[model samples]
Each structure stands twice: as structure tokens, then as C-alpha cells.
Target: MQVKDKVVIVTGAGSGIGRATALHFAHFGAKVVVSDIDLEKAQKVADEIVTNFGESLPIKANVAQYEEVENLIQHTVTAFGRLDVMVNNAGIGPKQLLKTAEHTLEDWEAVIAVNQTGVFYGMKLALQQMLKQGSGNIVNVASLAGLKASINNLSYSASKFAVVGMTKSAALEYAKTGIRINAVCPGYTESALLDKLLSARPDMDTMLKSIIPMKRYGDAKEIADAIVWLASDQTKFMTGQTLILDGGTSL
Candidate 1:
């Protein structure tokens, strides 16, 4: 948990929160494994980590696919000798799934596959490795929507809610196994996904600001900082907790 020379794996590291977190871990002296569905993007991040801090590996893994995720963990352990931290940050929110009743089955399935099932897979595989070693840390990324219902994000909310539940349940199950599991619920943040949504809706900026007491969107680095703390020795006494970084939006 010192992070110095620790082995950390971050999924969805192509861009946004995942990318920021992968770099953050590297900056803190962790040997990071950067994974993304896009190999080029993952490799780019891993390359940057090495270029800056000198230890990283890039692997292509679609969290939604069990084989890819399994391979990702196996490769990391095989290469790093032990997995110290697991950040299950891969997720998706289909823009068109904003309509509660009008969204397609495909959209719901897709969101659940990546957002819900993906987190589950990451936790399970990471727990397996941690059990073998008798210790580890895991952080699953949920959302403010996961903590509370949103107006027009049905599929996304449902999947994220599942993540919140999964995090709590798994954390309790492994509470005595030396493996700690926790969740981070990030509110509306400056992410590529949000940028796309804002581009589509002209009035989104004002609408979003009005809802958040902070009157601003969160930066990706802010969320990454929270994740690093959660995965570090600083939180050794904590587990099954959900850290809400929503800028008081939930209030």
C-alpha cells in the first residue's frame, strides 16, 4: 500500500478517469499495468508511465470479456510476481440510453455488461490473486447515479447501482481474507463521456451547474487522487465503503 514499487492494474486506461488514475499510480511509484479495449491507447499510457517513471506494461483487455480480463490478471501477476492493487474502472454509458422507457434492450445489456458485469469480473479475478497472496486492495468505480437515481440515465443508473451493490457485498465477503474491496462514486466529472453529452445538449452546462452545489464539474485528477488514497495503506482499516466525490451534489 506504500505504492512504491507496488503492482497496480487499471482498466479503461485509454482516456478519462482511468487514464488519469493509471498515470497517478505511476507517478506515486507503483508499477502499473495499463489496460484498455483500444490497444494503442493502453500502450500509449503504459509508454508514458515508463517514459516518466520507468515501470509499466500495456495490455489490451475488454473488461466485458471474461477471457480478456482473465488474461489481463494472469499476465500481470505472471509478469509482476504479485498484484498489489486492482482498480476496476472500465465502464460505458450509451448516450441514447438516457430515455428510461425508450432505450433498447441492447443498450441496457451493453451498459450492464461493462459497468456491472465488468466490475464483478474484475473483483472476482483480483480477489483470486489476492487470496493466493493473503493480501491486496481493490477499488471499483461507481457513480453518483449509482448512489441516487438520475432523471434521464436509466440504463447507466441501473448498471452503476449494481456496481455499488457488488462492491459492498464482495467487500463483506472478503473482509477477513486480507483483501479489501471498496467503491468510489464520482459525480459528474470532466470526462470524455460527459464532453460528448454536453456537445449534444446546448443547455447542459447551466443545467449541470445548477444541480451541483459546487457549481462546477469535477476534474479527473480529483477522482484519481481519491482512488490512489483508497488503494494505499492510508485506508487499511476501511473496507465495504463507498467514497462519494460528487462535489456535494448528493446533498
Candidate 2:
């Protein structure tokens, strides 16, 4: 176990990429805090972790709220004694695809609230705890869209691009302070998020695959594996880096 007994917090752990990351952390012997907007889903993942491998706690917090995000970090430290790893994995896309001109104010705001502001909250709180502890690892989830423009994904692209900027800026500021920060930009992963996207825009399924030279989507577990590896000491020399796991699509 690369991170034996390390206390790790994963936001948006109710389902999709978040759930998979939480479970992977637990499997490698980390104490995981499964945090989600839905307490029930968080509890289920935490319960599964307790049943199978390491210890876990379920926490309900809307990442869009600063107080809730603060509480999530505070609670994890109170229960586990320290914060070693933090995965800012909570994010949202717009409810419906709209062009730049047709986008509603509400839709844009909602996506920014969670995807951008939420990530900021998690990183700030985790840093407060880690700066005191003198070391930590932070992994923010970005998207291939962050690397370039995507069709029908205006708000999401903007938010994810902001995340990328945040990750790099923080990593530079703390490069020598014993904390490492990085981001993972995934492309067309297999998760509830992708399912919903495909469901809403059936044409997207075909359109999304056309750009991938590999002609395949990534798995949630695959993304989780990258997050886990980045959190480990094995990658101590790496920071301010955006590792794009997009099945060679960026190529």
C-alpha cells in the first residue's frame, strides 16, 4: 500500500468518477471520506468500503457551498486526525446544450458554481490543513475540453479550464513547501456523467467517438487509478502538471 492509513477525502463520491476514486483509495489502505450532495449515495459507498477493505466515512456536502466544503475538510480531520490527500472531483455540466448566444444565465451560473467555485473551496480548505501539517497531495479532475474547445460544451469548458489554471498556479506556489498539486484531464470517460450526456444528445455518442483515434471511451476505474498514483509519494517530483488521459485524443 503506497498510502497506508492515509486520510483521504473525495468530493462528489455519490457516483460516477467520484465513487470509483473513493473506493480505489480505500482499497489501497487509505481512510476515505466519501462526500456527496446525496447522503444516501455517500453512505452506500462508505458502507461498501467498510465491508471490503479500509475505513471510510460518509459525508453530505454540497460543494457549491463554502461552508459545506469547509465542514467536509474539518470533519475528515476531526475523525481521522490528519488530511493527507484531497481529490476535488465534484463538478457539473450545464443542464442543456446551448450555444454561447442562447445560453441562459441560470445554466451558466449553476455550472460555474459547482465546477469552478466548488473546486476552489476544496483546494483552499485542504491547503489550510496541509500547510499546517507541512505536506499533502491534491488532485483536481479536469477534462479534455479544458485542453481545447468542445462542441456544445461552452460552460463546462470554461469551468474546467479554470480548474486547470488553478491547479498549475497552486502547484507553483507550493512546489517547495512539501505539497504537490496536479490535475487530470480525462476525455470521454465511462461514467454517469457521460451516460447523461449521451442520453441527452444521442448524436454526441457518434460525434464524440469520431475524434478518438482509439475509438473507445475511458473507464471510471481507469481515471481513479491515475488519481491514486498521483497522490502517492512515488510521484513526489511531479507537480503543476496536467496529465491528460484522453485515449490519445489530444494527439
Candidate 3:
């Protein structure tokens, strides 16, 4: 599917996979709305896109908040005149060892609020606009953890699993409305978050790489390509599906 002239919104666009996706979409002639909690970082990404001769608007928003998400959609429509795609990619995965039954409830709630509730709010608002337009696409970024269980982080895994379920259910509900909803579940990817994890547990990095059949980590751009395609016409017939990018880890 051609990305030319498409108006796409990418949440958590300040860094990592979100940043990569936003830049890639802009390079493909899409008008991008880059949203992040870090306004400065989001603006920097927007400026970089503009410097590269692409159109982009950076807005500060916490996807966990419904009001902020509503404003994000409103601002994008106000700026681009229409909304074609919404990428629900903003999420956090702070390492939380569940070895102790005394894990902080606050941490658990925070993860679920952002990773699961955030995606729900995004889909809700995006669907509202898309229903009005009669056509749209929603590409949710889940994780390999969504499909499998995580021994170390129970909350993160549960939240992601919820995302997988939500994506499928929403896709089925909106398929006849010309709105396709799908998810991309990525395995260990090379990103700033991974670097932090490696620093904390140096040996775990090698262990993770060996677990993937390819014996390597994925690049952010590789995930971005899958998301862009899922958001385009190439996947018009596809919905209610979870496209895995795990390098055969799940196989």
C-alpha cells in the first residue's frame, strides 16, 4: 500500500520504535502527528522531520489520559484536516521482578494503566473519528510478551495480553465500517530500553539473543515497516489478526 499523503498519528514518538515509525511514515509522504508525554522530545522529532522536508506535528499527550488523547485527535484533525491512521505504540515496561508476592500495587497499576488502558483510550477516540469518516486503520504495537507469559513481569505481560484481545475484538466489530484494526507483536528489539536492561543485567542480553532462532535482535525500522504496511491498503483484507515479529521465538 502506498503511504503517500496519508495522515498518521504515532504515540510515544519521542524515542525508540515510535520515533522510528514516525520518521519512516514521513519519508513515505505521510503527514505525521507525533505524540509523546515529553513535549520537548516530540518537538525535536517533528523538527527533524521538517528539516528532512516532511510534514509533521508534535503534540504532548499521555495516552493514558482520555482527555489528552481526545485533544490529540482533535489537534491532528485541525492540522491535517483528516485522520487516516492511528498507531497505538506508547507504552512502558519497567523491569519488575515478580519473585516476591510483595510487589508494589502502584507499579502494577501504572503498567496496566499505560500499556492496556492507554491503548483502549486511543482506540476509542480513533474509532470515533474513523466511524465518522467511514474508513481508517489502527495499528497497535503489542509485544511477544502479549502472546506468551512473562516470568519476571506479571503486570506487563497481562497488560499486553489485554491489548492482543482488544485488537482482535475491535477489528471484528469495525471490519464492516471500513476500519481495519491489527497488532504487531515484536520480540526483543534493539532500543534504548534494551540498552538499559543490558546495563542492569549484562549476561541476560546474550541469553535473550540466543533464545531467538535468528540469534539476533530486531531493528526498530524493521518493526516500523510491518506497522506501516498494516496501516496501508496492502492489508485491507486483514483484520482481527496479530502479526508476530519474533524471529521464530514463538515457533
Candidate 4:
């Protein structure tokens, strides 16, 4: 689990799970690239890493755009020479939940652009660099909604399911090439995304907790730990698998 000196890139590294993952990877002595659509936030995270005696580089890139993601990879390689692990963690959901029929095409497209197509670009571009290096790891951040249907989150659910599928498919295609791809499906985690959802419907918090056997929302660091583990040599033999850290919510 050392990952010392490995070049790692974490998209959406500005806050929440993404931020935690960046810090965690840096903690393990990895040269981390903190990428996000928000340059200010990304830089702040990078500064924090530096303050903690870690190496980090903050770059701005919206994962939804192909060129930006391409530039992100390029900038990373320019700075670190090679990419060892890529965390496709940037994603967004509708501000308000809506039934499938009530979801507008605009809403669906927006979520899909960031959550699904964004992952495709990340994986494709990252694969190109990894292939040259002959060894690399990829970790996708999906959700419990991916494995199970959500009540009123058609776009989000669909996008995450696509992520899970893509992770498995890509993992198989690159299985023999020293490139391992996997996904982490987290449930009810204490992220800014969850805070927004709960803010909208305060009562939903209690309802959500009641359904989880753990009776508590997971900490961001908890999920970050799992992502780091999956990306480390300890799980070198693992690939094409979805590691669920939802406290039995999927069960």
C-alpha cells in the first residue's frame, strides 16, 4: 500500500471524497495531481498538501470536456513524467430529485456529460498514457444507485450504472496489459453532494440513516482509504470489481 513516488491524478480533487483521496494518496508519498473544474479550490487542496509536507500539483480541467481532460493528462505527464493511477471521481447530480418522466432532457444530458462521458474521456486518455508505461491503475467513483435503482434519480442512476459497466468492460480489455481498472460504489457518504441533498430535504437524513445497517453516514476519509487500497500494490491481483463501501446498504 506504499504507492511511494507513484504519479497519481485525482479528478474533482477540490472537495469531499476527491479532496480526501488526493490527500490520502499524498500521505502515502505519491506525487499527486489535484485536478478540478475549479482552479481556486484545486489549488487550495494542493497548497494544503504542500503544507503537510506532501508533493502535489493543482490543475484546472472539467472532466466533461475531452480537450480539458486530454490537457490534464498531458500536464500531469509533463510535471510527473508518467501516470500510475487515475481516479475518475468527478460527478454531479440534479439539484432536485425528479421522477423519470419528470426529468428534462437537459437534466439527463448534464449529468450524463459529467458522470458518464467524462469517465470515458478519463479512461480513454489515461489508458493511452498507461499503455506506454506498461503498468497503471484506474479507480472510478460510482454510487450505490449504480448497483441498485434509485427512487427518483433516473439520470444519476443511469450515469453511475454506466460507470460500473465501463469499469468492468475496460478492466477485462486491459487485463493482460498491466492496466487494472476498478470502481468504488459508495453509499450515503458524508460528502458535499450528500449535504446538498439533505439540505433540500432535512427529513431525508433520518430516513436514509434508518435504511443503512450502520445507522450512520460514512466519512469521506473512509471511502478515500478504500480507493487508495484498490490503487495500491496490495490489490494488484484485483480488477474489474466494484468495491462497495456502503455499510450494507446494498444488501
Return the top candidate by TM-score: 4
Stretches of candidate 4 above 4 Å error?
A: none
lDDT scores of the candidates, listed in order: 0.91, 0.93, 0.91, 0.95
How well does candidate 4 match the true structure in TM-score terms? 0.99
Writing each residue's lDDT as its tens digit, candidate 4 over 16-51 gives 999999999999899999999999999999999989
Q: Which stretches of candidate 3 lie over 4 Å from their true place?
A: none
Off-target runs (Cα >4 Å) in candidate 1 are none
Clashes of each: 0, 0, 0, 0
Model 4, residue 60: what's the lDDT? 98
lDDT-wise, the better of 1 and 2 is: 2
If scored against the real structure, what TM-score would every candidate get? 0.97, 0.98, 0.97, 0.99
Ranking by TM-score: 4, 2, 1, 3
Error of 2 at 21 (Å): 0.6
Q: Answer with 1 or 3, whichever has the higher TM-score.
A: 1
Q: RMSD of each candidate?
A: 1.1, 0.9, 1.2, 0.7
Residue 129 displacement (Å), model 4: 0.3
lDDT of 2: 0.93
Q: Candidate 2, residues 1-251: lDDT per residue as tens digits?
A: 48778899999998988999999989999999999999999999999999999799999999999999999999999999999999999888888888898887888899999999999999999999999999999999999989999767788999999999999999999988899999999999988779988998799888889988889999999999999999987898999999899889999
Model 2: CA > 4 A from native? none
Weakest 10 consecutive residues of candidate 2 by summed lDDT: 145-154
